[model samples]
Target: MNNLSKTTLIDQLTVEVYQNRNILGQEAAKAVVLKMKELLSNKNRIRMIFAAAPSQNEFLETLTKAEGIDWSRVTAFHMDEYIGLPASASQRFGRFLKERLFDTVKPGVVHFIDSENSIEEECKRYADLLSEQPIDMVCLGIGENGHIAFNDPPVADFQDPSIIKSVELDLVCRQQQVNDGCFTDLKSVPTQALTLTIPTLVAANYLFCIVPGTNKSEALKHTLSGPITTDCPASILRQHGHCTLYADDDSFELVANG
Candidate 1:
């Protein structure tokens, strides 16, 4: 991990490309864990939000294995979920995070967005839960269409008035779900989802964006090179003083070359 190369995009964001997703996740887990521990030294509790996706598997696995931290004082939250998925469905973002980290480590509190309930009430409920305190950090990834969480370009708002809301998924975002093998086909994917708006995600004191695979090369290009606008939702990360984007070799080749 120490041998991983580092580069700055526009001299505002720090980009580190690891050899592969495995090591990339491991190193990212290390950094986030260290930051969590540092925050805990000054505070009694810390709240964290996680993005559920195959891209986050390595990081979550390594994070659950990290020692010397008290899980009881940490609260967990997930970024988004499909609106129509069955409770027992493995594709549910809540179930995904539970199996990955929540169930393994047993955090003090785990708040999940209940899509089965009223979308309006669910949004208010989750938003209220998040507003109880400032978020310490967010562990997330960039979608193929350059989205953060489910904040796809169609609904991403930099000055969103609400914290969480229901949004229609863009074609590229829906396709990425199938591309990631979360669903059998496009028809099986949910068109609507509950997502934390851009303002909510960026409100965290720190953000760790873990993106891997060559499949993300085009989006990563736009994220690093494009203007800071909702057109490339993840591009807003450039304005955060404490955010870091981690990519693997294949995912960052284009950015590294240019």
Candidate 2:
């Protein structure tokens, strides 16, 4: 594996913040979509993983609106979902993807975790579905606590063999859901979730991590400067072969000033 501790690795993966968050989101989306298009042009098929949250709103909008890409050749998968939430639920990650991207384009396949089903069954089912294909690209966002997907500080593991598992929600992660308008209050959000594991995320050929806003500044710093431990789940991206971080002025402040 490549050494993430090397100065060149940090310099290579770190992207300077943009003047505005929206602009940063759009640029990152454009770059990833273009790369996806290039890969699809050569391979004829592409599998992609998407992360859903208020933070990814601009990025998804820009990707869905972009022209010339053959959406029909793309297969889509998402990062995580709240266990026990129906697909029709407003807070379901599947619904977010359908409303935000799938409905707008003719994608070949969309495999969504059925959070309403038995947690273990849902995890096994999604893992089986994903096991068949190698992900061409993954678009994700870092949580305020530096969590990736639902791999909160307590449960994240970079070397775990399990591709997907049920996990309890952290207090900070739940609060963030409410703050993002996914729910009116903490009680409205599910306490448990099914998320793709860190190992699965790192297996992707390319990773595009988009983080914006002042709220993410501290987490961004931890992700970039902190040790690669489960306590800082997003930091595992540093070990991936091809990973890019896109942040806005506020989110990149720590890295920039350092």
Candidate 3:
């Protein structure tokens, strides 16, 4: 927990601003590791969902090297994946997690969405795996558009009845992939993706949302100060009692004086 600069609450969500992205990732990993240890102390195993993007690089790196936790007792899942990316594409969420986390920690169980299969069947398959257990934790990030997972504003539903569903990606959401260096251009990014619903994400017992960078400043501001609406999807984090947002000074700049 180094370089913590500010802390506040918006509704039930706790916001922690660190001096930089490195500190933000370090502190977030430290807190999540402690939570994992606590949950494992009582349960035979714990389930966790992860978000894959450059925003998670430092956090995943730190978490993989954290000590004192039995990774064998942890089960992992990713929040979303593109429906059309080739299996070898590095931009694919599943590949991103494997290279960053699953391969490093070797979790007891890692459920991945196989988009190569029929889209409908793949969604149903992944949904069944998610429903088999209660998710104990989720490590996620907000999009530049303030969306969570792939739940872009145009398709986000706070009261969604589905555990997972495929949605057409909006222009801003697709362009963000290019902005993040995941795709060479917006045309190369997948137009559709399967994402865990907003309800499914908040259903987790604890949520750690790691968002950083000046690129995220405007979205972060809307998420923290705007009304709880799908217009700024991540704003719903405020309603989750156990969710915490980890942001760095750069990302918090716009909201610092609010």
Q: Candidate 3 residues 129-196, lDDT tens each? A: 99998899999999999999999999999999999999999999999899998889878999999999
Give the clashing residue pairs of candidate 1, or none.
Answer: none
Best by lDDT: 3
Specify the poorest-scoring 10-residue window by lDDT in model 1.
3-12
Q: What TM-score would each prediction reach against the true structure? A: 0.98, 0.93, 0.98
Better candidate by TM-score, 1 or 2: 1
What tens-digit string does per-residue lDDT give for candidate 1 at 115-179?
99999889989999999999999999999999999999989999999899999999999999999
- Sorting all predicted structures by lDDT, with the top scorer first, yields 3, 1, 2
Residues 167-190, model 2: lDDT tens digits: 999999999998888899889889
User: What's the lDDT for all of these models?
Assistant: 0.92, 0.85, 0.94
Cα error, residue 106 of model 1, in Å, equals: 0.6
Task: Return the TM-score for candidate 3, rounded to 2 decimals.
Answer: 0.98
> Judged by lDDT against the true structure, how good is candidate 3?
0.94
Regions more than 4 Å wrong, model 1: 9-11
RMSD of 2: 4.2
